[model samples]
Target: DSQKEANGLRTDHWVMDKRHSTYLFFMGVGEYAIVKDKWKNIAVDYYIEKEYEPYAKQIYGNTPEMIEFFSKKLGYDYPWAKYAQISGRDYVSGAMENTTATLHGSDILQKPGQLIDENKWEDTIAHELFHHWFGDLVTAESWSNLTVNESFANYSEYLWNEYKYGKDQADYHQMEDVNHYIHNPSDFKKDLVRFDYASREDVFDLVTYQKGGGILHMLRNYLGDDAFFAGMNDYLKTYEYKNAEAHQLRLSFEKVSGKDLNWFFNQWYFGSGHPKLNYSYTFEPVKKQVTVIVNQSQELPFEFPLTIDVYDNGKPKRQQVWVNAAAKNTFSFDVSKNPDLVNINADGILVADITETKTPEQNLMQFTGSKEFKSRYSALTAIKDQVGKNPAATKLLSAALKDPYFRVRQKALELMDLSNADQLKALGADVEKLASNDPKTLVQGAAIAALAKTKDKKYLSVFEKGVNAVSNSVKANSVAAVLAVDPSKANTLADKIDLEGASDELLSQMLPIIVKNKVTSEMSNIAPLVAFYPFLKFQNPELGKSAEEGYNWIMTSDNLKATESVTKILGQAKGQMGENPQVKMMISQMLKDGLTKKMELLKQNPQKASSINPQIDAINKAIENFK
Candidate 1:
């Protein structure tokens, strides 16, 4: 955790290798740590590490329990001989099921002496373990066959989370995405099936997890639960210890279900876009029926369930129907009462945008009035921008803000965006208390962040005081809160805080905040000015032209201070980065872009032109590019 590395210390890096039996086997140390516990299991010792030791232990203990749980449920023994889970420190790439070892980003790693929400942590642990059977034991042959790997892993998480934490906690709509789940075309230049991911960051996207998992769940609903698991068993038996692609998996399921499933995968996965619907129908009281015609178009071609809530005298009665085929999926409901409104997915069943038509105001009033904690929580989550104006409108929410659920209390604390600083401080203090009570990291982190944003000096002092006293995780949280409000605090702490012989945790804490602060406050200003999304630096044929143009525009803008920083950032690009060809090209193009800027500046502001090294160097580099 030292602030500076010892002179000549060797920094380790990772590259993909095919030397192992696993789909991806990786090794790295120093800045990149794999913190799994090593154990003696048969001939070869097993080493497993997560972001933290306690979380690793927790994950380890649960693996055997989950293995036993699934084995009994499936009437089959655990497939893998030895299991290990290693959580990445800030796992932007996502959790991977690599043979006996499963790796997840370490941001989810819970610290020792920190109280954790039993449900959420366990669900993540369970989700990865479920992969032992579906992904590790029987691997996907190619990344293109994403359905076999991600769908199974994701659905397994949902089933386990639902069973353990209830259907609400298995909430995909808000926590994840509703649009991608229903296949919205708004962001489909990045296709769900045929991948074009430039980096690992894009692989763990919602299209892979939420969309894939939701479709798989629907598949189970279409086929009986018995048939679904039986199909899984058949698929596993057919392709154990080997890689099978998407078509192979479809064939396996098709055999067990005795149904042609090619159309199912093709329509959903291979297709260009999703279904969108627009409809209107009036209820006739004499007929004692609710007749609603559904209108759809191939704009989305989405086939997901739409629940209609029939309200009579401000009370709701719910029913579900399929909004199938983008063309027009229509059905009618008959009842003695003429319903005031029809709400689609009122309970947030399927993840889709609420754009068809507005639900009844009375139903919303009832929802806001009810004391059901989940209802109040849902309303608060759904109304992000509208809540502040309708504070009185949300009865259950106002009451829920005082409710026992720590998350509920925290959310209530968050809504105190009053113009008065004292009001914000009061809410911040309450959130500080709730942070101790709530074991949820997201809630606690959100509370701390919101409190820090108050920008009051007294609040900053309170946060600093909290950091000085609390245990590591709690202290780290307070530090994070302070950093969010004023990144300079982290820099100040880095300058003052002694890192010499400090524990890895302390260094770990400092490095990320420092890098993040630098990225936002420092480097971001610098990167775009001197460089193009440049071919010499980050050369993707697709993005190079746009990035280059964007950088040129930024440099010519009137921000002189930014212009100075940009020159320095571009200077770094003149040298080598790594063997990655794209990296080289991007650096060159950025330098080239910077050179053009120097030529203009040389005539406009000659002294400033000489002051900026990259600009001067860039002027030379531009000529070299053409030469």
Candidate 2:
């Protein structure tokens, strides 16, 4: 142990083996309660705030179980002396894995009531722990190959969820990542194993984390779980306590699976883009066969493998096909019976942009009958986009409102558009029930916001109660519902809520409402919204963008008093926000932009120019100070 200080600060000191990298060293000093447990011969400790001591088991009691699972799953012993995790306030990232000790954000300290939904720490906690084996023990050769460290850690979330929370949760987690990756392909135009990054931080992106994890998932599905795990154990054993590159990992998997993987690596890891695909299928009932043609729209086409399932009166028969490395590929499969509906990406293995052409009847069947949540989710989402109201689709949406999964119910709420008088008549009662009684806050919030569109005064009580609810998410969204029903009440409601404890959701929701209604007459209430400045500009840049637009709207609202108040707010921020260069730059830009707009307004109407010249001059002086 490091020397105990004279003041007794309860410092923790843990040494790392010389083989590990220099960055793996860990130490912390704080007022924390240490909870201890053991997995075989390895000791585990969780250090948290004293106030959170009672909920320690709910928060991190699974550290020992996780260690045991990962050790056995990877066929690797616990490499470090002992393991420790602590929570810190205002942590920059979610969590950081240091050799023997991990530091997490204060959000990990949750009360027992928060666990009624699901363990918030499930993915992140398992992610950091997996780094001990993949990153801390083996290490990546260089910043260029960060996916070597991060990809495995990202994949470990799936492994842990599968081992502990069943495949439904694990598959749902993977579908979320795949959705993030496929929907946001612009972020991953660079090769996964690229070497020309401008900065190391640029390497830690959705591509390295989510896309790489999705690729590993495809690999696991490509080679069965046994082969994939065997390959993983071999790779870890070969690269233990030594830095390794992408090729070394490929060679290990290739050695265990006894198959060449250069084709897979060249198309995915070393490659630059994924396949944006669209497909159409034609079934010939007389021959009991289906012919599917897939077209690639990406600049660089990828040869992606897929399992196409043909449902014959609800019984599924699957056939493997490849969207070959070309502009377009075709496949035909002989079925045992006439197919009722076709499911694309049946296993949801590969991350690609896949659109399958199907009729409304086929979509309704998939939404009701598909076993996988992603399939049902995709079906319902596609149905939501259709223009005409089909009674069959509406019936499916009504039934899906009671889906066991919250996301499914949320989608059902979104698809139940009350703007359509037909839909309003069919599902209004069900929507009211969901708004009041849905178990998930997100679903309830969605239902309440949607119900507001009906202009039903009876649901006003639900919105009023939700606006004052304990959950910040519910309160923020309910505020939106209230504003939707009666825009006149925004100013009074804005004054009542405590802005200090309000979330970005509330700020982002209410900022536009208050600005639209010219609610900041006294300017005293505006200060709380201004506190969000400089900080929110980076933390939630979109909300920050919205704040900028709202501020611009206020300045040009033609109310000199309100415009003057905004000017004073910017002037106050000029001095207090100069420490952060980014914040300083943003404030300067806003001042300059606001000044230019004010000058333009004065040009349009010379009568009021004289009244506002002093304020304009003051803003110009503030701009000079920024220089």
Candidate 3:
């Protein structure tokens, strides 16, 4: 409520819900432009910068739909007076669930051109909103049981994708989430819910978020959707506006389903490591049966459901069996003929590392016959390295380029050997078709990049067309493609494009192009490329290496404009790095080393020293200010 004071000023009174956690409290003060929206009768608003006002709805328009969907799915009405999302400059986290108000990073703001391709922040929006139920209404009692809050929010991303897009998109997202935990070997031995953590922050790693979500998915599959959702409704209703632990959640599920979930919860929630299986199969033609063997190499054996797909004469027959608590288990299935393919974990429900022995021909059969996305994806991954060496492998990859799922198509493009003239010549038309006509912007970008590797002048028109594409990814790849085909257009393209909000993929592609061509005309546009080095170095080492190459080139360049732009970026960055002294000191040391190197090079080449002296002085000033 707002009231006018005697001095002709307005004062606003704010009230929050009585039953919220202290951590969920927030107050934002800024010159923000509020975009007014509503869901049913409740107020919904977006607070963002004035420059991004026009694109506010474009970024957050689907919020109301998401709210309605989550409420209906959970069988609970939204329990807040209003919903508001505010974008903060240099936000510490991607987003936070602050009761009815959510805080997000300024990167959520995008231009019309960028949104035309995709709103990259949609998943994050869904995540924080879902937390209003999982994290706010029903809070986790302790940090050790954080899955009651975070894992549900993480799974919300998959649920939203499955609802808005299709299962293929959702499965692809789940695959990425599972891989996030699988690739982090250090976190593998940590239990999902442990009381032995040294710090509260230690419990917020991938195991809690990604692995926890995967475990929930397994539970959902085990219980079936009807019972799973019913159990979820029971849990939320019983614990509304209250704190609960992991065991309470399991008890709620048991209350609804009338089954002992001790095994599921104990093995998954308390277990330390995932099952690592080595699978082998043998066929006994005399008895028309196939014997499949599974060996668990981990310390403890896990009891779980496993799906096996047996193929005979290009036909698949699926069988579901339970793996007991034994290190080794063997199962035999009667078949009509010699088995063509024996695929374990055919549905890919389990979050485990699997090594299966299959021939290239059998994998091709599995790829063609299996209906699950993971099955086809695993088949493609197994045969990706043999694309140029084996004719069957090359043909399978060629067929995969036209797969129904966009990620499958994108993966095929990523695995293609563009340097192999024989492979490129054979599949050139198919790849060019995908580049021009594929519905998915990411797939189209990958196809354009694949065609660019050939360096054929005829495809210059394709790259030129892609330059005007709506997707920043396609545009970035197209610009790099132009540089690869003809180096003369580097300066012109560099000056025209803005790199301020470019994706990491875009930056990774263009940074090398900028350094290779010595394109210094648009130093302001390239400043983001240099400023992004500190953050990117830890997140992605390969991209960090590319950004480092660009940074080093700017520091040592003879161009005065390049040196001035970099130093200005560094001096401004020091102020923002106050909270992160390690990054601040790293930047300070980098500037000092760059200055020392530039002075040494100037002394050796005296003839060019006069022209480069101004650049050296600018670096020295930046280093002094950075300290």
Candidate 4:
């Protein structure tokens, strides 16, 4: 409650509803530009920085629609008094669900140019909003069963994408989620719900988020949407404003669907590791039957439903089979003729690792004949290594450049080896055309990157135009292409590019160029560049190396103005890092190490210490103040 006094001062009071988890309680006190909107008489607001007042609507405008969609989808109304999202400076996490108020990172404040391309945080918005039902209303009983809170929120990204965009976008998002889990083979050893984790933070890993979401997707596919959503609605209602566990969730689904799901809950939730499947088929012309063999190589066998599509004469016949707890299983299907292709896990719904034996011709047939994005994507991945060596593979790669899905087209562009002159000759024109005219900026950026491998000057004009594109990805790629063609324009292009709405892809591309070209004009943008250090250091090592190079250049640059700007920026960063002690220590140590290396260099070359001493002293002082 806020009331203005006769003296012209306002008093505000906040009183949160009872029964909410302490973790979901949040309070924000700061000067904010409150952008007002509403959903069916309920207040929906965005609190952002004053400078981003105009873009407040653009950044969070869909929030109201998202609330409406989630409420209707969950068969529940927005239960709180109001909903507010506040963007905090240097926020630690992406976003958090706090009953009626959510907190987001300052990066959520975007410029008009960034929104022109895409609202990258839309999925995040949906994720946190869905938590209103899954995390807030029905809280997880324990950290051991965090999937009850996080998995649903993670799957909400796919759900919202499917509803708002389409299945392809959702499938692509799911594919990335699956990849994030699978990339670290060690994580596969952990169960979705484990009681023996070392720390509460240990539960918040890929298994809880990505793999858990994939399991829910498979469960949804198995139960069908009607029963799945019905069960979800029932669960939320039963446990609203209370705590629930994974078993209770399963019980809700079982009650709604009238099917015992112990096999699923036992194996997926309680068990560790996924099935490693090797699928092959043998054609028996005499019996007019194809025998499909699936071998599980993992130590423990998994019992799950598997789909196989037998293509005969360019038409598919779907076969659903259950693989029990066995090392090997075989199923024979009577066919009219030799099967054209035997595609396992046909819908690409399963989260397991599958190696299917298929010829190049079969892969191409699957790529063209299959309607699903994952199937087509799998086919492309299968033949990616054969692009330059095999004629059919080369043809498939060329055809995929025009695939209906932008991700497919982008994948094809990524797979193409444009460094080979013959391959470039075959696909250069198509690549250039996509670079110039593709509807998706991501695909266009990829096409531009593919062309950059050639280092040909003829495509300079295309790159120059791309520098002015609305998408940061396109602009960054174009600047890279420009650098490849003419190295002299590095500093000029670096100065022209705006870092206000830059994406990680843009930063990754430009940091190397900035360092290699000694482009010190980007000193004012040092905050974001410095902020990116921790993320890159842990998540992306190659980019982290480039950032290290940039840091070294800044600390030791011959340019006095560049060094002075960095000193000021480091001091400001130290002040801002007060809230994040870990980051402060990390930066402080980095500065100490850098000073050590510079001192060694000065000692080795005594004549250079006169010029280097002042720079070294500035970094030392910054480190001392940082402490």
Please state the error at residue 263 of candidate 2 in Å.
2.1
Model 4 C-alpha lDDT per residue in residues 202-290, reported as the tens digit of each score? 99889999999999999999999999999999999999999999999999999999999999999899988888999888899999999
- Model 2 gets an lDDT of 0.76
Better of 1 and 2 by lDDT: 2
The TM-score obtained by model 2 is 0.76
**What local lDDT score does residue 446 receive in model 3, on the 0 to 100 scale?**
88
Per-residue lDDT over 92-124 for candidate 2, one digit per residue giving the tens place of the 0 to 100 score:
668899887898987687764344334677688
**Candidate 1 TM-score, true structure as reference:** 0.61
Ten contiguous residues minimizing lDDT sum, candidate 3: 516-525
Q: Give the lDDT of residue 126 in candidate 1.
A: 67
Clashes of each: 31, 0, 0, 0
Model 4 clash pairs are: none
Off by over 4 Å in 2: 2-13, 30-43, 49-61, 87-94, 105-122, 164-166, 183-189, 299-301, 311-316, 335-340, 419-421, 460-469, 475-507, 510-627
TM-score result, candidate 3: 0.87
The residue-level lDDT of candidate 4 at 134 comes to 93
Question: Candidate 1 at residue 112, lDDT?
Answer: 44
